[model samples]
Target: MRKIPIAETLIEKMLFIFTVAGSLVIFFVIFYIFSNGLPVLKASGLSFFTTGGWDGQFTSAWTAAPGQEIWRFGAVELIAGTLLTTGGALLVAGLLGMGCAVFLAEFCPPRLRRPVEACVRLLAGIPPVIYGVVGYTTVVPLVQSLISDQLALEMVRICVLDGTSLLAGIMVLGIMITPIFVILATDALETVPLAYKAASLALGVSHWRTIVKIMIPVARRGILAGGIMAAGMAAGEFIAMAMVAGGVAFLPNPAHGLLFFLEPVRTLAANVFINSEVLGKANMESALFACASVILFICIIFSLLAQLINRPNLKGGRSR
Candidate 1:
């Protein structure tokens, strides 16, 4: 091999420096969020995770220090709502999207794959805000009508929640994320070695069995990574969820749960959006930052959990 020219080497080194600089900007931003966020966290203590209360006025009346109560926004409800909606969305998106991916990858004709892939990509490109609008106008009304009729028949004590319920948020998020799962899974399935399929077929194994026992096992990490990405996307959703999540604060009850499908629920992202209007107010501002910090922590935890779950499969991929 010929040695690189000094100028070319220097140019490559400069490109890497630029990339590192960009990465450090993001790293420092996260550090700043954690730093500004830590003081409130320390002051709030464990109660931050336990208590659902967020009334700073009530906190101030009993305070020893002025401006101290600004740190009192407990993030439990926001955290809970965020998890519930994101989990619900992931469950729906994973089942539907992965199944569709499997079919497209394993069963569909090669002639049909290109068009189908393009359609899925098109769906994925639709903005999250549009999904929210659809959920608000279409999904919420449908849910309310069905829920009202069902509650009338099944339970006497039913209270109808407006359309901004957790269920609505989940449904919107699921639809929004389905295309991602399909795209990722389809790519993964395509990457599976054809020799594996041929060997299983030669052994007289059913196609379904081969897919279940061999192909899926091998592609598990990719599928899992797709699922985790979908969940992360759902958690970060703001515009569409903001439109349909109703932005209410409370731990949902099973009894009132159906109402969650109809009523509005606040997510961490939505809280940040709604509260930003009062950003100049010290308590409200700090509270929004606290919520942001908690959201970041939750996202980090979820990502770690996904990696841990997929560790074996990821290792298997490396070995192969």
Candidate 2:
């Protein structure tokens, strides 16, 4: 046998080292965030979650001047806004995307499916900033004309409100994440065994009924995973939501029903973007990082719950 090349051995060693290092770096970053955020959590206690006030003025004896006091960071408004907008987006995206997935998987011809699937992926490639600009110029004006102007009919003043309200944010986010759900659901639907479909058909079940009852149930786990991913996209979308969510600090009322559509809203990431300059130091920035940690935690919990719900054997049904 020829002598082993030293270069090849070195390259293999380098690649292995780099991969392990990269993985450890990711873990380290996560650990650092949690460590830093713990202070805020402890300071906040239970009230941090229940109360939406973020007063950044506390007196530290070591740092306080004779008459000066300073406090920094606790942003419940941002948290609430982020959740509401993302949740609304998830609702619309999930329904429309799952519906499209069902149609594509069960009804469309293979030739039609290929192009449709390609288009769905293409939608995911569009930039969030572009979505924001479109929302501002087109979507906001339409909302103002159709809804705000109508409300103005009874009032003396006509306000051209922000197009970045909670509803607008939801619609934009829904459009953004729809592709992921559609693609994933479509893939899952395809994996559903043809035998099941045939058996249903042999039993005289309608084509639509077979798809609804048999195909969907089998692919539930994969579809649910895709849904969780879509929700993550919606939740983490900062630039787009920042532009379109009106960035109000106080929470909007869901009980106001459609009023949420008209009013401005803020999200946690949007808050970080807006108020990173608070106190002219990195204190607020660190606080924003803590907020990000919280969002990540929420996403992790949601994914866990989805996994629990979507487990194949949990329903005691056979999966093909």
Candidate 3:
């Protein structure tokens, strides 16, 4: 057996202790949530999962009117609404974000890169509430006007899709998440060794072609990693989504068909926010906790996915 240095041994023990402490903290929190949250599920049975409505009071939420305090809970609608907005945001963000990252890392002049990257990162630092406010004040009105004009031109009946809609939420969320995508993905793209770039250029490969064929493959995993991070952020986002998604706990109106994008929605995080604010409601508390538990599980899954995506790089490094 090889002798170990005393200092190195102490560091190893310290690291192990820190890891276990972190795990125990997570375990305790999860245990606490589950223990407190399961009572609602037991009382409601499968009906809680089946029905798609929220019949709780939101007296404290200034943006929403005071709703009835009747004790009732179901997450189907919330889940649907949340998924619609979050997925829509991801779709919008993914396209613009990936393209921006590619251009910033590969095509932009070296002199312009820093300022542009700084502008994108500035977005990431802004408070989520600011994004919500901006979306509500600006994007919502614009969307409403455009959609209203189109319907008027086609002689379609006027719908009350006044700014606070699934479309607005998607727009706000996508914009907020884009910075995350650009920052992480740009780092990944830059990490591709210069030798590979030089070799491809020397071999008469066009700049765009080499980037698509060589650099992309090497950095694909990291780009995906950025997407996963952005997805997690979008899913957890509440303030902006609540502001733009009309604070209704239902799917888009099916009447308009494609106009569903203009419908109001309710999300899990927003539900938690509303319900948690109302005191003296044990059942609602438990139900909201259940929603929180679900969101937590989703976050955990995204984290695991990020780790799995990075494993190929890890394995390759070890082999080499």
- In model 2, the clashing pairs are 56-71, 57-71, 58-70, 58-71, 164-244
lDDT of 2 at 27: 85
Range of the 10 consecutive residues with the lowest summed lDDT in candidate 3? 56-65
Against the true structure, whose lDDT is highest?
Answer: 3
What are the models' TM-scores?
0.87, 0.82, 0.83
- Rank by TM-score, highest first: 1, 3, 2
List candidate 2 segments past 4 Å from native. 1-19, 55-69, 149-161, 278-282, 306-320
lDDT per residue for candidate 1 within 107-214, as digits (tens), equals 989899889889999999998878887889998776666655555455334323555677788888899999998998777776678998899999999999999888
Q: Write the number of the candidate with greater TM-score, choosing between 1 and 3.
A: 1
Number of backbone collisions per candidate, in order? 11, 5, 0
lDDT string, candidate 3, 179-279, tens digits: 99888888888888889899999999999999888887888778878888898998888888878888877666677786788767878888777556654
Q: Cα RMSD (Å) per model?
A: 3.8, 4.7, 4.9
Distance (Å) between predicted and true CA of 37, model 1? Answer: 2.1
lDDT of 1: 0.76
